[model samples]
Target: MEKTFLELISENQSILFKICNVYFREKVDKEDYHQELIIQLWKAFPDFKNTAKFSTWMYRVCINAAIDILRKDKKEIKKLVFQKSTYIIYLIMGLSPLEIRKDCLN
Candidate 1:
């Protein structure tokens, strides 16, 4: 069971990271979110009957955890949004102008 959970985590680690990135702006906050996610996943794994794709189940769990965290830290929502916007701008700046224009159109 431990090995199975480890394999699932290895395969979906990026999903958890992406969720953390989306929900928490500060590096420290993101790390906290990641740790929280790992703990939640560890606790929830035993009940997972494999009724669906593990990634799908994991994503649902991640989103729920993120939302719960946000609700608990309501005052930080604005800060998180601003930071996420800044990150997006930075990501766009790193892209080629052509890519940026394409992204804008989409």
Candidate 2:
């Protein structure tokens, strides 16, 4: 099972890379995200009931990991500027306008 999982991961490595690219700005951040995704996948493997395709399961795992990382690293954008007049900050942070307004009020 371990060997099979290793082979599967090797074959689908690009999935990890793509997720990392979507979420991370620096190469090191991408690598960290990839590693986190792999760890999450391994931890969740035993309970994978296999109702869906492996790639589908993997994609969900990758996206969840990327989002988790994004949430954690959100404060890293403190120095970056978004036009204050528009909803650009909300858009960049992947929040809906309602969510952004709620956040801002807090």
The candidate scoring highest on lDDT is 1
Clashes, model 2:
0
TM-score, structure 2 vs. true: 0.65
Candidate 1, 1-106: lDDT as tens digits? 8998989999989999999888899999999889999889889888787789999999998899889888879868777898678557957679765675676578
Against the true structure, candidate 1 reaches a TM-score of: 0.67
For model 1, state the Cα shift of residue 68 in Å.
0.7
Candidate 1 residue 20 C-alpha distance from true site, Å: 0.7
RMSD in Å for all candidates: 14.3, 10.3
What ranges in model 2 sit over 4 Å off? 75-106
Q: Residue 49 of model 2: what lDDT?
A: 70
TM-score of each: 0.67, 0.65
Q: List the residue pairs that clash in candidate 2.
A: none
